[model samples]
Target: MTANGTGINGVNGAAPAQAHQAYQYSKEPLGNPRPIRIVVIGCGVSGIAAVKMFKDRFHNLPVELALYERNKSVGEPGSRTVTQGNPYFSRVYVGAPELYEYFKGRADAYGVPDYVRLEHKVTDVSWNEKMGQYGLKIEDLATGKTITDHAEVVINSTGILNAWKWPDIPGIHTFKGTLLHSANYDTSADLDGKVIATFITPELALDLAPKGRDTVYSREEQDKWAEDPEEFLKFRKRATHILNTGFEVIVKDSKEQKETLAMIKKQMEKRLSKKKELIPKLIPDFALGCRRFTPGDGYLEALCEDNVTVRITDIKEIVPDGVITSDGEKVELDALICATGFNTGYLGVSVAKFPNYFMTTGPAAPAAHGTFIPCIEAYIKYAFDAVERLMREGIKSICVKEEAVADFQEHKDNIVHDFVWTSTCRSWYKNGTVDGKVWGPWPGSGPHFLESLAHPRWEDYDFKYRTGNRFQYLGNGRTIRELEGGDLSWFIKKGPKHTREELTPSTVSINGL
Candidate 1:
């Protein structure tokens, strides 16, 4: 029910409600332009968007924008990876089309070319009160050389997945075969005839098996067995393991293997039979939506291949050339693909250490509500909040309201317990210090998040505007009144709901809703 109303639980769909607005004031003509140098810490979607926005908005001013990245090219570990094909087409969010259009428009409007100082890894950040800026020390990941940069503002868009964490299973090093995380899963061609085991999340079941088994028992028969719990469980267990679409082999002791396969097949059948009923209860043992669901076009189908085996065995540790399970069995894997994901080093300390910088863009930490929507929503809020802070105060530089940072973290911690998703202990999204306790952001819905970020909340942040700078925040008491207003309001002040146009891929043209 929550999902239906919210469209997706956590996504905020209605237009953003109003907060206290900033007071607007007119200023006299500016004299000389002030120089503002900004350093954006990553070249991913967030960094690129921020750079372009700055160029377009502050083109006439003495503003210098520099982007630094550790990857040689754009779209590194955390960047947008566009997968081609009809199957992968839907992976890109619907909100992405608008984003593309926005970026394209900004690029065209400003002559600033996107530049990245690639192969640079940021090592440390130190605060300098004398300079009123944060100093960043970085190491060139390629050559191992150190570099430093200081700017009026520093944005850490250096996203999650920058570092990978491996399971601390003993004898892991002894396993002679290749061991890699899921991030290293580049292709499936190597899985041709070798036996491979993979850990798959239940969310990926649809992608794994798109079609029902050809030899499955009829629903009528299944329903008959369902009358008895013990009988049904035993039967279903058999069905979940066996059926596959690949080559079959017959060995001398294959009877036991056959039975094992049959059990898995039966279990899978039972799982599918109860899909609708289980949707509400299907929470992961770990956090439900913590780590991103590893999605591939045909990962499930690949697992169904005869040579590939899906196991739920609890791993003990890695043995030379194989893996040992808690059940006292050893699996010999040639290459260990660590499909395990990364560790997000979410700092628990206050962002106050960084001077003059305010939270004006995205979540200071990682937040994955529904990929694109909430990210944009939260980022925009930060943007408007910063602008409003500047408008209210005459001071040019301001940092995140120290109080808001604490409140925001406390708020984030409180939400971690309410949702079943956060109840799971296993997740990269959890607080680095606490288990089953997530310090990361709560996932919000895309549409809802967009509406929330539409308005600026001036009172929510601590801001100090600078009179030394030529720019000032200009605010009108527009109480985010667009959502409640009817057709009359649309006529009065042409709102985005009426005038917002979709950007087409071909030419820059507005297509109305």
Candidate 2:
């Protein structure tokens, strides 16, 4: 989505110098701060955060926020973490259901649910150039009613894992079994002793299927965490520090990566010692953390079970009641679960051709390197910074310039080329392909991603102001600071951290117009 526009030099360029004269106001000061209508799609963590930010920061302004969510209630919208088998303890560390509650809880705590339009699915969104607004086609899931809405600003907080795809295979429909996509799994379907063939692995059912590993913390430890708030905070900080500092292990050809890989390989090989043949077939050859690496607790032991059979053969096709291997062996299965994958995206706060649009958690975000919470907050703040600029400057539309997007992409590609994610391996990071661009991770570590978005470069955007000129916001060569009760000396440094009640030996002030 390449857009052609000048940053601040061409026809749409900004010029503070109003050659003719300054704007003169009639009634109000700052002359009616342009009323902005903002629409948010997807009530995920990002969407919820956007609403909370609006309440916290955009208050007392003419900003209207409407959030549309597809689900009955707010929850974490998308990801690999939602469907992975065995609920890995170290990586894929938390349960999907629990994660859902956490996100929903955050929103509920902030009263963000009040602003949400639940059961409202956004079917399509497009920017109307003439109107200078984004038009959204929405469908209410409850009544099957469709609606069209427009907003001056649109935020797509819908994370990448929303779109799930079935693996393209011949005669897949012929399989006479309960087929399921991980994103749309039916929990009621009984998998007890059923011969399940999975593209990835099975779901929570396998978490404790006789051959399971249970990790239990001591009662005293639990009480300590529950009783002492400081203790819990300390633990969280320690865990975050570890995850953040371990970025070197994902660096291409780094000593840390090599050492970490060897340690994990030895541990996995030991776990699979009973069924040694599976080691060669299951163990990866690529760099560690290249794919979604999880400690599959009891997975190896389950494979060692009597009924468990491992097949590394390619699937020729699926016939009635079974799958035909490339080696002419037909394996029977009661169910087929395609944990195939989702359509990831190349995302930044704004994209070309989409004016006044923002994405909270997109494919290009720093997802894999460490904890995602900080990054999500950073993304929201970065996006709203631009929004604030538009509001303050009375801008109608602001789109990231084509050159800036191109440069960011180039830098991202170059940096990713040296990361483990871009190694020769089939991964969702590369859009479920073996050899393509890495789409699901930022170019650098999570901190780097956060740092990059810390400040927005104003010159990287092309903006069209509401009054048709950038200087229109200059507003009559007068400021509200000149009005009664306004702090005229706010620019001066406060005495000793604002300790002084008044300036010492104060001189009489004059009101000059």
Best by the lDDT measure? 2
**Model 2 global lDDT (CA atoms, 0 to 1):** 0.72
Mark the regions of model 1 whose C-alpha exceeds 4 Å error after superposition: 1-33, 77-113, 186-191, 199-304, 347-350, 358-368, 371-374, 377-396, 415-417, 431-435, 463-513
How do the residues 1-513 of candidate 1 rate in per-residue lDDT, one tens digit apiece?
A: 000111111112112222465534444222233466677677655665666566556655565677778766443323232221111223332123333444445434443245567778777766554344567788989888898887666666666555656666787678665555554444444655554555433432323233332233456655666667787666544532231111121111235435544554455444534333332233233322334433323333444454545566678887777888889988877766554445666542125434444332233243444234235435633653453333333344454445666777676566545543354345555533325555555333334345555564445433333422223323232222333353433444422433235544443434432
Instruction: List per-prediction Cα lDDT, in the order shown.
Output: 0.47, 0.72
Model 1, CA-based lDDT: 0.47
TM-scores of the models, in the given order? 0.59, 0.85
Query: Model 2 over residues 1-513: C-alpha lDDT tens digits?
Result: 222343322344442444676555434456446677888888877787787878988888887989999877886644323222222233333445556666777888988878889999998887665566777889999999999988888888888677777777899988889898777777689989899887663232233233224454456655787898899678677766767888898899999999989998888899878889988887789888787663456666777777778787678999879888899988888999887677776666787767788887786877676666678788788778877877777676787778888898888788887889988777777877778888758877777887888988878887765554555676766676675457776666523333356534453223321
Best model number under TM-score: 2
Q: After superposition, how far is residue 200 of candidate 1 from its true place, in Å?
A: 5.5
Candidate 1: worst-modelled 10 consecutive residues by lDDT? 1-10
